[model samples]
Target: MIVQDQANDFPVGPEDTSASQATQDQLHKSYRMPDEQARDPALHIAKDWVQKKKLPDMSNITDPQLRRYATLYPKLRLTSDGTLFLEEGTGDDQRLRLCVPAALIAEVIRCLHQHPLAGHLGRYRTYLQAKRRFYWPNMHKHISCAVEGCTTCRQSKERKATKQVPLGQTSTKEHTRFAKFYCDLVGPWPNARGPGTKKYLLTLQDAVTKYPEAWAITDATAENIIRVLTNEFFPRYGVGMTIVSDQGRQFISTLFQHAVKRLGVFTVKTQAYEPKTNPVERLHRTLENVIRCSMENEKVHPTQWH
Candidate 1:
């Protein structure tokens, strides 16, 4: 794997045309010629360095071992056209890979990341594209940095959005069943009962068992909602200590507030736009699916959805 040529052990020999052709074929499978000379800034630096037959001095390298390698290694070999490169691998696996200059690292990354034929790819794919024909110190780090900074690549990829802060304890201190209920309004569904008869849906779910209760109401007004809660919900599930609902006008109305307060019930309202905080909102999707599928089948009519 270490394809270096020193005075002893591994010595640099005359170039083999057949072996070189094979390497070229392998490289050709992945490598595409850059569109213009200026596009890959590393190539320009390499060309200039080769033309001058000189490399930047690394005499100030703090590590003695690294200073020695820096002083001796790069000058040991070059490509046929005199471009600076590191000879890697051994025997049949040997390859002459481009030695990228630090100044051109960003440019090289841009070229590889946006390579017309192979650009706009993921981090690993972009890294492999560059790896096929180039070498540099911390090459992977640079490639990863480039991919992370690439707006096109980042925007094109589909990724899930995760909440940074965890929702600690979701429910109230009360541990009793039906102690807390999450309430929300589903929608103004398409005219299910003739025209505008049963347009809105009121969804209620228990915080403990996740058992859901829903009612189809003509409107989302306070009177209509309190009727369902008092007659249908409270009678069936029994009144709980707390009612959690979103900040809808109906939930905050004086009539509904007085109605719950008369029952010795506490009302907790979730912040606007924070749908996840309201557990009943999660059930709306399943409720909608059930309603839609049932309406489609001949056995169930939309008016009978309630």
Candidate 2:
């Protein structure tokens, strides 16, 4: 209200004095400032200038860090009893507000966001609650970041792929490193490549680490499937003790069954049409989302996932 407009070098004119003082009085009565800023050195200096007429010469205020607070001195005010306030917003909507220290911003954001009546509400609602009583630079950015990173909001509010079934009984069993894996097939996706115009993605996931590997294949033949397992996967990670896959033709074929047995790896097939019995099926949604977002962000062809 009756703030020193730091941008201006001169004192207030006589005509503006009464109205400005009245506005300041109204604000002081309507809202209370937080006590935290009273101990803040920057605010102490600001208050000295605004309320006690003790403005220190720039050179005398030796802390270079204080310059940031000094710059805001003109916009800060102190009530008759010495509570610090900041003049914010614009005319008709302009008001004095409690100043929040940098250290307390996160706590303030959490309190407002998780307030019983307002918990899990979106950004704008949380911001309004904060703006009503607190004033800070880049307050909106702070609020937005806090709300977006909220764990509850991420888990419950955000849209995600529907789960087909609970994590399978096999998934709950402890898996030894390089001993158990979940395998699945994804796509007849666009942008087919390689010999036979590859269109399918063969996905393998290590159950212990949850690490996944994928390869593009033109067909789901038992020969191609066995080749991926023996040549590509087995060589790098060593032969797993057990391999789990949906009961697709390629997985259940005589060629695949014999090939895995010869390699000393046991094969377990999921119940018919129950893809969730193989853990890798759950990862397909996440994998597709990753590829879709990457293509959108990088301006690449959708088939680039191949």
Candidate 3:
């Protein structure tokens, strides 16, 4: 009965078997191993010890390479086909990572990084992909060097210029509110028929509390700026000790300087082109965005922004 069953299982009368044979051949070609891990000199000692299930004592091992394998024996596992793997992680998260030899580390990294799926990613990302299936000493360092030396990446990627100057301290010893003020002018927007036909905005920001105030004016002249500070700002918040502003013509004018001096407030002009030194520049961006949104919501023309 057993012989009869085996004979029936086999193809006794072959009929149109060419397609089936081709499919079987294709499957065998696709499933074969890419390279021979047994031929790697670095993993030969570990493979032998793992196969025998007997690790020699590290104290008596004279060879440096053999001693290294002895140290890692607990984590090493040998496959039936002689390939070595490093057992990593714990419990449900555990993985068997192929132990790559030193000589093949660069080739493996190149394959992973330059592969169409990899898209030539950065060092850390490529290292993460490699970590999923390969194990080697100083793997991160090797991958980093490989990425840095890649001619394609060097030629294609844009290098960002780092800021040379460090940030300057902006905090004051006195925590008093309204102790310092950052002042700047925004626009000459489209002329609108508001109070004084307002087209420009004079903005002031408190250094301590960061409280901001703005006034619309017809022009950005020194006289107009001084008039606003004297009539409006000083009456409400009182005079600040220090006034920080950029080197605008109005801020640095002799008339503007005299006006602040009368109030016993020191005026500081920022460097020629460095607006970052003044905190009010940041306030301008936020204020402009708010104005833009409000205009859009109200269906107001640019000329009627005031």
Question: On a 0 to 100 scale, what is the lDDT of residue 210 in model 1?
Answer: 83
Order the candidates by lDDT, highest first — what do you get? 3, 2, 1
Taking the candidates one at a time, how many backbone clashes does each contain?
Answer: 0, 0, 0
* Model 1 lDDT per residue over 1-306, tens place: 223333322132334333222333333353433222224454554445545666666654455434433554654344433335556677877655555545556766775655433425557876776665566666788888877886654444445575699768654565677888888897777545565588788888888878788788888899999899889988877764688998999999999999999878789999898998887875876566445433343246556665
Clashing pairs in 3: none
Best prediction by TM-score: 2
TM-score of each: 0.42, 0.47, 0.43
Which parts of model 1 are misplaced by more than 4 Å? 1-174, 193-196, 299-306
lDDT of 2 by residue, 75-128 (tens): 776654456666666766666666666666786677666543343466887787
Report the lDDT of model 1 for residue 101.
48
Q: After superposition, how far is residue 79 of candidate 1 from its true place, in Å?
A: 85
Task: Write the number of the candidate with greater lDDT, choosing between 1 and 2.
Answer: 2
Cα lDDT, all candidates = 0.63, 0.67, 0.70
lDDT for model 3 comes to: 0.70
lDDT of 1 at 256: 94
TM-score, structure 2 vs. true:
0.47
